[model samples]
Target: MKSSEAIYREALAQLQRLIEQATAQGVEEAHAAALATADRYAHPSVRMVYIVAVEEAGLLFFANTESGKGQQLIDNPRASLCFFWRELQEQVTLEGDVIRQSVETSDNYWRKRPRETQLAAWVLPQGTPAPEKGESRRQVRQLEQALGFEPVPRSPNWCAFRLQPERIEFWPSGWPRMRERVRYLKQADGLWSEALLSP
Candidate 1:
């Protein structure tokens, strides 16, 4: 049997290859994923978030600290993510403890965003109800005027969250019902190990 560390390295390489291919093919949502988070009581909440960064270290995504999932993440730092490449018939699921990124990291991503997005982030109060009807559109207009072409600042509460994965699973479809799952788990020695799980 191959050592877990060896298998993990191989799988990560395969994953990076898949992501690169999907991106190159002009896939609309190649960088999107379903992120699952739980609250203090262990109740789960799942939502889709754009995948900001993918690397050997782990995944990085940004969210407002006041959003529903963000609040949940604050209460319970454990979370998971699922990335599916439908055309390629492949899926990667990752789970780990969530930690806020440094101020510099969040600012870096913020600067990359469009002016509209940055302004919207400022005007939009996540997880809160707003006035009904055209209130949303009106708010956008107000936000645009407020910024007046100036640089949109990144919110301190809207920093990036990094997931240092403890588990990484790749599920690729096979003929009929013969599905396969390959998992990489972090060992106590601070290295990742791998195993196959029954579907």
Candidate 2:
């Protein structure tokens, strides 16, 4: 039997390979995944988000702190994510607790983004009421003009969060709805355990 550390490494390796394959197969938004979060009241909400980074510890994504998902994550740090690749007939699910990334990390990422995108972020505060028609674009243009040649600054309310997954499951499609499911659960000692689930 493999040790917990080995199983954990293998699961992450498998995920990386799947992500690469999906991208090679021309799947649009290959990094996109459905993120599920719940508020303090335990009310659940889900939305699609692009997984910006896949680290050994977990995955990372960004959002406005005042957004619904961000508020929910702050209130209840646990969340789930589901990634599906129709072309590869594969799916991966992750459940984990989230932690905000450091200010420096967020700044680095924000600096690398295109200027227009950064301006759009400033103008489009997530989950906020929509501005009057054309107001959003105007705001972006106005901000850009005001900033002149200076680099766009990162929004104080915008940041990234890392989801340190406690459970990860990989599903490979099989004929006639039969699928093979492999799950890895993180152990108390910070390792992991592997299991095969009926599908």
Candidate 3:
């Protein structure tokens, strides 16, 4: 068997490959994950977030600054992410501190988004509200004319968060009641300590 450290390194690399495979296979929610965060009062909530980037620093996702998850992150920086790929029979969990991304990085991503998406971002910073009748459509049209052919500047309150991982666990399911799990945790000096868990 490979050493636990080797397994840990492979687990990280496997995530990138799995993401590519999911995209290639036309999975609509290829980069989706359930992100769990605790609010200032220690209340917890979980929601789906589409991860835009995965790097050594952590997983990157964008959210409205004042949204419930965003506010929770601001009050309590630590969070956890769980990714499950049904087709691949694999799941990955990561726990870490969340850090806001740089303005330039957020702006660059914002530019790559479709114009309509940018408009939508402006329209709904929080979850979409059920406005009375045509009120919502009215806002969309107004935003369109107001934002003609210009990059939607990243909102100061709407930005990206990167999870600076301290612990990572990978699970790959097996036949009929069998499974395998491996965990990797950061050491005091930044190296990762790895272990296998009985399933």
Candidate 4:
């Protein structure tokens, strides 16, 4: 049997390859994943978010701290994510504990965003209700006028979160009656273990 570390590396490599394949096939939002989070009460919420990077620790995504998902994550740090590429008939699911990245890391990502996006982040209150239509658009316009070509600073509420997955499963389908599923689970000692599940 392969060591836990080997299985862990294999899983990461497999995910990266799938991402590359999806991009090559011109799949729209190839990096997007459905992220699921729950509040303190265990009510679940799920939405699509772009997985910008596949790091050693896990997957990284950015969002506003004040957003519904963000608030839920704060209240309950456990989360899950599902990535499916219909074009390739492949899916990956991850379950993990979420953690906010360092402020400096968030700032770095913010600096790379387009100026318009930065301005929108400044004016848009992510999880709040807007009674008036185009209110956020109006605010963005006003903010743009005020900034007047000045660099838009990153909002403190906007940051990146990483999902350090304790469990990850990969499923690929093509062969007839040959569906297979592989799962990797992180052990308490920080290593990973691999299992094959009936599909």
* Superposed model 2: Cα runs more than 4 Å off: none
CA deviation > 4 Å runs, candidate 1: 1-9
Clashes of 4: 0
Strongest candidate by lDDT: 2
Query: Against the unseen true structure, what C-alpha lDDT does each candidate score?
Result: 0.83, 0.90, 0.82, 0.89
Q: RMSD for all candidates, in order, please.
A: 2.3, 1.3, 2.5, 1.7
lDDT preference between candidates 1 and 2, better one: 2
**Candidate 4 weakest ten by summed lDDT:** 171-180
Which sections of candidate 4 miss by over 4 Å? Answer: 173-177
Return the TM-score for candidate 1, rounded to 2 decimals.
0.88
Pick the TM-score winner: 2
Residue clash pairs of candidate 1: none
TM-score of each: 0.88, 0.95, 0.89, 0.92
lDDT of 4 by residue, 23-91 (tens): 999999999999999999999999999998998888999988899998998889989999999999999
lDDT of 4 at 14: 90
Residue 108 CA displacement from its true place in model 4, Å: 0.7
- Cα lDDT over the full model 3: 0.82
Which pairs of residues have clashing backbones in candidate 3?
none
The sequence of per-residue lDDT tens digits that candidate 3 reaches over residues 1-199 is 6664665566578778878887888877989999999998999999999999887667899888788998899899999999888877778899989999899888888888887777767776685566778876788789878878766766677798898878888877655646868888887776677788985
